[model samples]
Target: MISHVLIAIISVLLVAAYLAAVLAGNPVYSALSMGIAFFLTALLFVLLGAPFLAAVQVIIYVGAMLVLFLFIVMMFDLNKSSLTPVRFKPSTILSYFLIMLVLLTGFFVARSVVRMPSGFAITGFGSARNIGFNLMHYYLLPFELASFVLLVGVFGAIAFIKNRRGT
Candidate 1:
């Protein structure tokens, strides 16, 4: 009973943090909110009996990624006085509408296709050993592809910096 209540409270906090991240005008506030959201997500993973995932969420996302994001935002030297109010042009409004339409359609389609598993408790489901085995065996290609994508992004960023320096 306590666990369920804790989960519900953490979930509410997670949602609130996410909303704050999305709605915040200042980049720093947005990053901080996102960090809170990530931390709450990690707590949710722990509640679901996935300690490994929770650790990864806290270490990789909240620790590394959010720190990197905050660093980048700080490096940009954004001036609050220079920030202009968002103008919703017709094209922007239409694009947002179209994106929402697609997302809603996808949600409904996915809901029809996917069914929730009956069993909630799965021992060793998120263990490091099990995760390693599955990643190396079942999901090796996707994992490699993701690494390759990150490598490409790093290279692209380096090239962009070099070009900027040259110009």
Candidate 2:
């Protein structure tokens, strides 16, 4: 009973923080609010019996990705004057609305399937041990490829920055 109440509270807070992040004026403030949102998401994952996912959410998204976003925002030398309110074009708003509608439709269509999965998971299905084994055995190639791509992207960003500075 208490856990359900806590989950509901956390979920509401998470949505509010996410909205704050999206509607923030400053990029830095947006990034910070997004970090808080990610932390709340991880907390929710922990409450939902997915501790490993929660740890990954905190470590990869909150710790690493948010720091990267902060660095990028800082690197651009953005200031208060540059962060003033901007108006979106009608086309852009319409596109966003259509995309959201499509996503919601798809979600509802999939929700029924999710509620009645064909196969049940084995014991400790979502545990760290199971994840590690599956990652190592089945997903090793794809995982390594993703890491390689990220490494290349980092190198490209460094090169771009260096070129901009003529260094």
Candidate 3:
């Protein structure tokens, strides 16, 4: 009971912090809030009995991705004057309404399916070795593609900061 309460409180705090991040004028604070949100998500993953996913979420997202975002934000030296003010229009309202409609439809559609539960069935090995084996066997192409995307991002960041000719 206590654990459930704590999880619920933390989840609410996480959402609040994410909203604060979005509204914050400072990029650095926004980055930190993003890190907090990622960490909270990792904790939730742990509570759900997926330790491997929790670790990956922390290491890859909170550790690497959020740190990278913070580094870039700091590297650019963004000032308050540089941050653009947000404006809401009729289109924005329409888009949000559409998103809510889709979400409600999904909830109703999923209700029937979620009630049916199959008997306990576990097949896949959750070990690192098994993960690597499957990745190499079936998911090799997509894995390679992701690596290529990372390489492109690396080069793109480097180029973004480089001095251009013909100033």
Candidate 4:
């Protein structure tokens, strides 16, 4: 009962933050709100009995990605006064409507798929060491790719800031 209530409250708060982030004019606020949503999601993972997933969510989403976004936003230091205000065109409206229609259609189609209930609580499959071994052994390529992406992002940020300084 308490768990459900807590989940509901946190979920609502996270959704509200996400919506505010999406609708806000300021990009910094959007990034901050996204960070909040990511942290809340980690909590949600904990509530769902996935401690490993929760830790990964925190480390990857909140720790790494949000930090990168914050740094990028800070480094860019965009001035709203200098930027032109973007206006929506009829084509943009039409595209958004079509996307929404497609999403709705997909959701309805997927609603007919079989649902499985989680069985009684069971201990996790492997210890953290075991999971690390599997990830390093089996999923090494994907892990390396992810690391490469992070490296690229860091270099890209540095390059952007350097170019700005040179200009």
Candidate 5:
């Protein structure tokens, strides 16, 4: 009862935060909204009995990643004089349409997970030990691939900054 209500509230908050992150015109506000979304996602993980995931989410993403993003945003020189008010552009409309499409697709995909089988047990499912075991054993390749992708992204960002500076 109360747990369900709390979940609903948190879910709403998470969606609102993400929406704000996407829609905000100011980069700093967008980053802050993303941080709020990440924190709420961590809270949701905790409520779902995945404390390890929640901790990782907060420590790695909300703490480290958001700070890095904020630092990068601050490092760039944004010209206030060149800034213009947001208008109803075709790309913006398309992006909103795509967002709705993805949301609906996700809802449909996850609708089946609302009911669990009677024989299924969820004990220690999201534990650090289980996660580590799975990461090291079964999902090692994908994990390494993701890390490589992130590395590429960091280099790409650095290159972009260098190009912008004409250095």
Candidate 6:
């Protein structure tokens, strides 16, 4: 019961942190809030009997990804001249409408997920060795696809930076 309470608290804090990140005016504060959210997410994983996943989440999401984002955001010297707000075009109304609809649908789907009971409490579930084996066997394709996506994203970021600098 205590554990469940703890998990619930962490989950609430995670949501709050995400909201804070979204609503923050300062980029640095947003990144810090996201880091807190990532940490909270790792705690939830640990509470759900996935310590290995928690460690990976901390190391990858918090340690690597968040650190990189923070560095990039910090490196940029923001001022009124460089920090212009984007103007939305009337032609993009359909796109915005579609995105809003998708977000609403996702909210409903996520709401339903809260009531679902976890029945996959088997032994060795979410263990490092188990995950390693599954990665090598059942999830190899998806794993490779994710890696490919990350590689493409890295290239995209590089390209975006070069273009922004008029290189």
Which candidate should be chosen as best, given TM-score against the real structure?
A: 1
Query: What is the per-residue lDDT of model 2 for residues 1-167, given as tens digits with 9 covering 90 to 100?
Result: 55576578788989899899999888888999999899889867766766678889999998899999998898887876767576798998999999999868855754543342233223354668788888899999998999999999999988876866478
Q: For all candidates, what are the clash counts?
A: 0, 0, 0, 0, 0, 0
Q: How do the residues 115-142 of candidate 4 rate in per-residue lDDT, one tens digit apiece?
A: 2234312335433555677889999999
- lDDT of each residue in 1-167, candidate 5, tens digit only: 54476579789988899899999988988999999999889867866867679889999998899999999899999778757777999999999999999868745644543443433233467778878888999999999999999999999988876866478
Candidate 4 lDDT at 16 equals 97
What is the per-residue lDDT of model 3 for residues 37-144, given as tens digits with 9 covering 90 to 100?
887887666555444566788899988888888887878767768677787989999999999998688557545443322321122234345667788999999999
Give the Cα lDDT of each candidate. Answer: 0.82, 0.80, 0.74, 0.76, 0.82, 0.80
Off by over 4 Å in 2: 81-125, 164-166
| lDDT score, candidate 5, position 159 | 85
Per-prediction RMSD in angstroms?
Answer: 13.3, 12.3, 12.7, 12.5, 11.4, 13.6
Model 1 TM-score, 2 decimals: 0.68
Taking all chains together, each candidate's TM-score versus the true structure is: 0.68, 0.65, 0.59, 0.55, 0.62, 0.65
Runs of candidate 3 with Cα error greater than 4 angstroms are: 1-6, 76-127, 165-167
- The TM-score of predicted model 2 comes to 0.65
Greater lDDT among 3 and 6 belongs to 6
Off by over 4 Å in 1: 80-123, 164-167
lDDT of 1 by residue, 77-102 (tens): 79879577889899999999999998
Ranking according to TM-score, highest score first: 1, 6, 2, 5, 3, 4
